[model samples]
Target: MTLIGRTHAREIETLSLDSADTRNALSAALVGELADALTDCAGDAGVRAVVLTHTGSTFCAGADLRDPPHPDALVGLLRQIVTLRKPVLARITGHVRAGGLGLLAACDLAVASTRSDFAFTEVRIGVAPAVISLTVLPRTDPRALARHYLTGARFDAAEAVRTGLLTAAGDDVDAVLEPILDGLRRSSPQGLAETKQLLTAKVLEAFDRDAADLTALSARLFSSPQAREGMTAFLERRDPSWAV
Candidate 1:
């Protein structure tokens, strides 16, 4: 079954994460499908911009415990988003957690509804937000990320924008994105691609310098004892032994 639903109109392509059954978790198949779709968008001259959105209440709930993608694959997917020639924008109106924030950060622009909430949930699962930091650290405020990364607390859309996680948030997400999409529609394809490259240089640098280390770290942590206990407890709907 297809996990991504695609639609295009007026040169704008919309890719929706359609795996609501798993809360659109980053399963291996989902990741691979998304990567291929993105590559197609990147090569299509008729596609002016891409909108990454989701079908369910949760935009994404991080890596799928049942069928997670390899750490290296996750890193590559994030890098692809950061380096995609045409602009990629995230249109969110739901909760985002853990690795999903990495996807949001990789996008050139992100807008969400005021109702959306976000959290870095990796720490609760006995893993750091290691792989995601490549794109996230480059995009967000260090101090804000420090607190959220360590505590795994939930923050609202306004706080997300203040911390540079979101470009804007509003009562109506579509209303918020319309003007931005109009601007993109007006922009020359070459102008958008070149400007996006100029904007994403530092983000790509982070991927170049730190991706290998972070991917290794993520793989190690996910295989460790603590993560096993955390995952088990999470599936069982109980607290891990480390929880107070």
Candidate 2:
């Protein structure tokens, strides 16, 4: 079965992460499919806005540890979302973690349910949020990032908004998102595209300059003994040996 599903209505295309069994983890297959969908939406004149969302309680649990890291694919997919001619909106209804925050940051706008939670969990797994920091660091509050990135603590949707990770959060996601989508639909495609470029120029430049270095850092960390033990401990439902 396909890991990503697409639906369209009123010039808005919704790309749903369908891998609920994996909590919509960013497996290589899922990332590839999402990139393809975004590319299709970018070229479709009927599509004016794209909504990135999921079907399960966990929006995305981050990268799948069962497989090797796909930093290039993840970076490419984020680039596609950021550069797509259409404005992309993240419709978050559940928890987000680690690499998933990268995807969320790449969107032009994001609305999350107040019930949702978020974290930069890489440090706990003995890896740094290297690649994702390219997108996330620009948008998040420096103080908040220093705390969350170092502690791997979970924060609620309201904090996510206050930190600039989310555009808005409320008990009703659709209530918050529909109006933004409506505003986007009213905007001319050229207007949205140009405005998005102006907004994302720094992020795009960071990607161009630091993507390779960050990917290498990620690979090194993931392959380290500490990360191996950390991930193994997580899968086994225990703390890593290094945990004090």
How many pairs of residues collide in each model? 0, 0
Q: What residue runs in model 1 are displaced by over 4 Å at the alpha carbon?
A: none
TM-score, cand. 2 vs. native: 0.98
Which residue pairs in model 1 clash with each other? none
Task: Please provide TM-scores, in order, for all candidate models, with all chains considered together.
Answer: 0.99, 0.98
Model 2 gets an lDDT of 0.91
Once fitted onto the true fold, the runs of candidate 2 whose alpha carbons sit more than 4 angstroms away are none
lDDT of 2 by residue, 1-244 (tens): 8988889999999999999999999998888888888888988999999999999898899999986448988888888888887899999999899999999999989999999999889988899999888899889899988999999999999899999999999999999999998899899999999999999999999999999999999989999999998899989999889888
**What overall lDDT goes with each candidate model?**
0.95, 0.91
Given candidate 2, what's the lDDT at residue 8? Answer: 96
Estimate the TM-score for candidate 1.
0.99
Question: What number of backbone clashes does candidate 1 have, counting pairs of residues 3 or more apart or in separate chains?
Answer: 0
Worst 10 residues of 2 by lDDT: 66-75
